[model samples]
Target: MRNQLLAVLDIVLSARLVNANVIRIAEEAHKAADPHLALALVSARGTTTNPVEIALDLEMLDAAVDCAKEALAEIEKIKRVVSKNVVELEAAPSLPGGDAAMRRDAIQENLDEIDEGFQICGARLQEMETVRDIADKRRKALVARV
Candidate 1:
């Protein structure tokens, strides 16, 4: 029974860690997918024949694409971590005695949190993908103009 309690505690701690990671990744994704950054990429016109201006625009587009790709990768990591946590929660042993109900409740709460985190990550991933696509298109357009 003592071992079972310890196992439950370990699972809870692991779940908390996963949640923290998810939060961190979401923040990163939010920064990478900033609406202003996307707008800047979309609004930047390579119509000017100035070599310097075109080069600068290309550099900016490249940076945006890199950031978006990194964010997308981070989001994918979060998804995998969350999925693993869900599995752990499911496999956690029920505590003995009156604590059994409490353990079940804690597991359920962790699952709920993981589900919410997954949903949030999904939205962020979509946003990051959109930003990446816009940056790619803008970069191509700029390159073509050059």
Candidate 2:
């Protein structure tokens, strides 16, 4: 579980640096285009750059990932727990049409639920990745004095 926690924890923890970089760069980019936006970014960057806030945001992100992972773990545990009963129910020797079909339906439903959650998480992660990549390139350009 601890190892699983660490693995799943990355969804939030590592993403923070990505998100921070994104907001910082995007804000700078938006601001660079205009005086008013730059002014707004200046205010936002200050709050964002604060050490306390940075740490808090990072922890919050990690916790969100952890919660998601915890829920996933629970589902997996549930699948395992019910699997035996599922097999027995579906495999009953006297049952008509077979218990396997019944088990299949249950498993399919559980899988569908898992797939839905995973898709949402995947979309969010992809957005973060897109933002981070843009931010990195922008920073590199600025550093190059471009």
Candidate 3:
């Protein structure tokens, strides 16, 4: 369980770092190009560039940032839940609140939840790759033109 938790943690952190970098790049684009002004200029041109294409990339990058933020929150919650469980697991059970069977069941349940969270986080990180691809393509197109 600990190993699996670590794997999930690593995945979440990596994705978050990547997305955060993407956001920074977007910020730089906004600064360097005045993306809003560029969008307006493209709109004024009327037929040269498709505004929808730029809009889609912007929207997806926004969603990706939000998803990364959510993943971070889930990672924190998982850490706290597991930490609490570890503490409880280490305590010596006294006169009848928790028997061996109860403890075993609790441990198993926690493990299962952790694994499920692992799957969810893993899937989110995989989706982030798609987001990165979209962003990279859009960014490269901009660079090519400049």
Top candidate when judged by TM-score against the true structure:
1
Question: Per-residue lDDT for 9 in model 1?
Answer: 73
Q: Per-residue alpha-carbon lDDT of model 3 for 15-101, expressed as tens digits?
A: 445434434543443343334334433433443344356555455555554555455455555545554554544443432444434
- Compare candidates 1 and 2 on TM-score and give the better one: 1
**Which ranges in model 3 have alpha carbons more than 4 Å from their true place?**
1-52, 94-100, 142-146
lDDT score of residue 22 within candidate 3: 38
Candidate 3, residue 76: Cα displacement in angstroms equals 3.2
Tens digits of lDDT, candidate 1, 12-34 = 67667766776676677566556
Error of 2 at 32 (Å): 35
What tens-digit string does per-residue lDDT give for candidate 2 at 1-146?
45434433332333334334433433443233234222223333443434444344434444443444444454444445434443544444333354345444655554455445445544543443343344334444444662
For model 1, the local distance difference test gives 0.59
TM-score preference between candidates 2 and 3, better one: 3
Report lDDT per candidate: 0.59, 0.41, 0.48
Q: Which candidate comes out best when scored by lDDT?
A: 1
- Answer with 1 or 3, whichever has the higher TM-score: 1
- TM-score, per-candidate, Cα-based: 0.58, 0.40, 0.45
- Go through the candidates in order and give the C-alpha RMSD of each one to the true structure: 4.5, 15.4, 12.6
